[model samples]
Target: MRITVWDLPLRLFHWLLAAAVAGALITINLGVSWIEWHARFGLAVVGLIAFRLVWGVVGSTHSRFASFVPTPSAVASYVRGHWRQPGHNPLGALSVYAMLGLFGFQAVSGLFTTDEIAFSGPLTRAVSSDLVATLSRLHRQTEWWLYLLLGLHVLSIIVYRLRGIKLVGPMIHGRKEVDQTVPQPRGGGVLAFIIAVGIAAAAVWLANGSWIPVPPPAPAPAW
Candidate 1:
């Protein structure tokens, strides 16, 4: 039987987040000229993460956190090869949570970073210098962690493919073929989607430091 395992919003979120993350990584490495783009991508990530977090609550059954949050017993069951059901498995759930958390931290912390040159985060001026320095250091350090996680994520996809499971297709198309009967996904209707979009837009606005009142242009330089 074929079933809808991922809703459209979730699928869009997955791909858009991937693109934003990639853009951030690439632009950041391209030197000062690309820093602005890197910041733009990071802000995009902030919105995407915000949307996903909200969607995880009100999204369709399979996409909800309640559907696949990893429990100790569930992990044990998966390890013992007795775990069976659709959507994220217990072990995969751990990776999902870890990626979300790491990316969220990265995006939020980036709001305070400064290159001490041509680029500065939107929130850099709002925070103390010491705090900005600390966050900047952490941001640089944690970047490697994201790379590690990304590598593992791709590796896992490859491994699953080797085991005759097609993970990417289902995510792209939002459906899967399974032999066992499973309940159809529900929830995440228009109202829930609207709420999610509103939250995400607000996050982008905040991440851009739009709430911070801009200082009036300094009075024309005194002669």
Candidate 2:
């Protein structure tokens, strides 16, 4: 039977984030002025992730973190084929969390990173030089890991496709055919969506240093 596994909000978040990540990665390869765009894309990611965190709490059943965040016992049970429910499998849940963590770190770190040239993060001026240097280093170092995780995500999709599981279709259309009893999403209407978007916008604003208090101008140099 066909059942709704994802809601409009979750689906939009997924695709929009995918596009933002792709845009940021492309900017990385392009270099030069592209890094400016890369930061924009990264900020978009922050908004999406911020909304996702909120949605995970008060969103739909399948969209909720509680539905897919697995414990050690749950993972073991899934490995043993004891888990037959819908939504993310235990293994898939780990990958999902890992991806989110990676993107979250990248977004947060990018706020304070700088390339020492034309490129600087939106909030780079908000932090000390030492802290900016630290985050800048971390931002560079974590790019490789993010690529690795993205590769794994793609590989998992391919593997699942080969095994007759159509993960992509369900994510796009928000419905999937399954024998198990999969409950459709509840709540998460326009009001919840507006709230989530508001939170995301606020995060983006803060990350951009809109709320950071500006320091007073320095006095004239003593001759």
Candidate 2's C-alpha runs over 4 A off are 213-223
Clash pairs detected, candidate 1: none
lDDT per model, in order? 0.94, 0.89
Least lDDT summed over 10 consecutive residues: which range in candidate 1?
214-223
Residue 188 in candidate 2, Cα distance off native in Å: 1.5
Q: List the residue pairs that clash in candidate 2.
A: none
**Which tens-of-lDDT digit does each residue in 144-206 have in candidate 2?**
999999999999999989999899998999987878765666878888888999999999998
Backbone clash numbers for all candidates listed = 0, 0
lDDT of 1 by residue, 58-124 (tens): 9999889999979999999999988878889998999999999999999999999987988789999
User: How far off is residue 101 in model 1, in Å?
Assistant: 0.6
42, model 2: CA deviation in Å? 0.9
